[model samples]
Target: MARLCLPDGAVRGIDIQGAQTGTVTSYTAGRDGTVTVDNPQHERALRQYGAFPANLGGRSTRGGYRCGVCGFAAYIKTCSRCGGTCEKES
Candidate 1:
């Protein structure tokens, strides 16, 4: 069981509350530095990493994203969505 961080919001960034146990349902990360957790309980821990609910409808930048803003290299090849844009995080 891994812990997930769920931060409501802040200036510096999100934070981790605690941990949980569950199989990862789904994940989404784009070129942006963020990660979304589909696991219900892990929501709190996910925030610590800097993930937030995106306007993309429960979508957030999946792991392995390359953030040009932060010079972060994305490991995952952009996700596929209907409008060509990754539906994970806008």
Candidate 2:
């Protein structure tokens, strides 16, 4: 199982498959993990090299987002540490 750490610190397991025509990336969540990116550059890279590294989520860097309610800094898309939703500055 591959783990993807979202900006909100939410970790998701994903199943990645590669095909000759393109690559199929599947993430695991109730239903939210089913988005497909058809970037040819990413596709070519996947075909030539491989999937993301095992340590993709090893680091914990948080920036570019903050909790709207409490103004707390967030690493994940959602504010896991603060139990609030995080939003980017507009």
Candidate 3:
């Protein structure tokens, strides 16, 4: 199982293939901006959608970057949403 964390109040939609069939399943973040994925496919889908893995202690891991233009936070050095430079966050 995988636990993905997003910014507080952020919402994300994830689409993954069903385990037993070819159907596509969709998932959304919960009220606290977290999603728990029970399958590897779901985990990959959530990561692709910009959700990062949550630390084991239930807090977001630090040392990532936050976009200056759109305020998106991720591990990447560049902002994928607005093509803006990202500043490292403590």
What's the TM-score of every candidate structure? 0.25, 0.27, 0.48
Clashes of each: 17, 6, 0
- The reply for model 1, stretches above 4 Å from the true place, is 1-36, 56-90
Q: Judged by TM-score relative to the true structure, which candidate is superior, 1 or 2?
A: 2
lDDT of 2 by residue, 1-90 (tens): 232222222245344565565565654333532223355544344333333322322232333566777665565668756688878643
lDDT tens per residue, model 3, 42-63: 7876676667766522235378
Q: Quick one: how many clashes does candidate 3 have?
A: 0
Which has the greatest lDDT?
3
Ranking the candidates on TM-score from highest down gives: 3, 2, 1
Q: By TM-score, how accurate is candidate 2?
A: 0.27
Cα lDDT tens digits for candidate 1, 1-90: 322332335333443443443333343443353455545555644544555444322233344443334333333444322122221123
lDDT of each: 0.39, 0.45, 0.70
Q: List the residue pairs that clash in candidate 2.
A: 7-75, 7-76, 7-77, 8-76, 8-77, 9-76
Give the TM-score (vs. native) of candidate 3.
0.48
